[model samples]
Target chain A: MKKNHSGVRIGEVTLKWFIALHLSLIVNSLAGVASKMAGKQKFLSFRFCICYGMVLVITFAFALAWQQVLKHMSLTFAFTNKPITIIWGLIWGVLVFHEHVTWKMILGSAVILLGIMVGVSGDSGSDGSSLPPEGGKGDV
Target chain B: MFEGLGRYIAVWIVSVFISSIAQVMLKMEANREHASKLKEYMNPMVVSAYFIFFLSTFLTMYALKYVPLTYSPIIEPMSYIFVPVIGVLLLKEKISRRRLIGMGIMIAGIVIFSM
Candidate 1:
């Protein structure tokens, strides 16, 4: 019984870590996209080139970290938790873009958040356990 | 003004959906293709070089043109959020009661978070 409970706890922790890693991906991707859209064309300015390079480097680093994380976690859990970035994006939009938040948008985000929580909570099996082998081909 | 906002939103949605499909298809293709050629695929030196070239040449260009950088990443998460909905509609997958409840709670949380 104790072993079973511990296993469940470990799974929950893994899910939370997966969510955080995905959040990093979303935030970093947004930053990269914003930089590019700001007219930081390639080879235009030395500083812009440096910034773009840095973004690429950091994104690659995060991709590596994510590959490591996936080794111990289920893809379903990881992928399901990834959608929380939509909620984060909404937050960023309000703060950065000064977009108005409508009730409908709010409701939609709530449904997504609730769905992720419940999805993670209900899973207790070893389905989707076939993780891609470690140090395999990875992407950013 | 109404039409303008609607257009923007529609374009955003369509672009994101296409990109999502692209991502999934790429992953699926890469996995299936590489499994048979594991020796070549697992060659990290080659894969890293390929990834860098692919991102800079293909993925980045399409992404920047169709979707604003700032918003694209945020919207990328929608792929996951909508997967179940897609499964239900297109694949005829069943949603259990627990999943329904979870979906409801997620909707509520998203509302609060957005505000």
Candidate 2:
């Protein structure tokens, strides 16, 4: 039946997004390795090494958490929410690192949020009929 | 010491390869099942990503044996930012004005985040 086919198609798309979320984490890990190695070789300066190392630790933790999240959430929900890390980074910058949070920072966060909203709205509208009626995709 | 550099570079490349495989696996796994189907989660890609995921973790630990972590995360996100650019260029994906604005904001955030 058409309904069954649509259900299968929806499932397929949902799976793709899940893979994308996981791939994002994997790519992030690889980048961490590359940067660390670059710093060790002095291809990047010493100052860069310290900064890069902190990022590696943070991202590693995040990537691990993301793996667990992927086990439970839809890819679309998970990935669209990933950028919220910027908000956390902003908090870390202000609270821990004592960095400034300029108007630009606020503006950037707002724009990113807006874009995510728009994208999510578009996606949901297009796939409205295909998605499961209850529970739908799990939260990220 | 120079030999050590070569060794690290070799390890890094291997890590990249493994990480790429993990990415592909994760992608394939995501495509096959809804997140709600947690009970029925058996896919070759999921298995591969997990295997490589751990391998990358070890490789990362070894890498940290020589390199510092500070610079790693800064550069790490570069791929995430860059891959989309490649998609835009190679796949001919349209970059909407809103998305472009969003990317610009993200770039600025990255600079600030780096600082």
TM-score of chain A of each: 0.53, 0.45
Per-residue CA lDDT of model 1 for A1-140, tens digit only, reads 12353353344454346456676556444543443433335554676566555655655665676676666666655545554545655666566555566666666665665566565446443543121111111111
Interface RMSD of each: 6.8, 8.7
Report residue A111 deviation for candidate 2 (angstroms). 2.3
Per-candidate DockQ versus the true complex?
0.28, 0.08
Write model 1 residue lDDT over B1-110, tens digit each, in one string. 42753454444455445443334333434444344566545655445544544443333433444333334322443443454455456446456666667656655654
Candidate 1 C-alpha error for residue B78, in Å? 3.7
| Residue B114 Cα positional deviation in candidate 1, in Å, after optimal superposition | 12
Regions of candidate 1 where Cα sits further than 4 Å from its true position: A1-11, A14-26, A32-59, A102-104, A116-140, B1-3, B27-77, B81-115
* Model number with the top DockQ: 1
True contacts kept of each: 0.36, 0.07
What does candidate 2's lDDT look like per residue over B23-42, in tens digits? Answer: 53454355455656663355
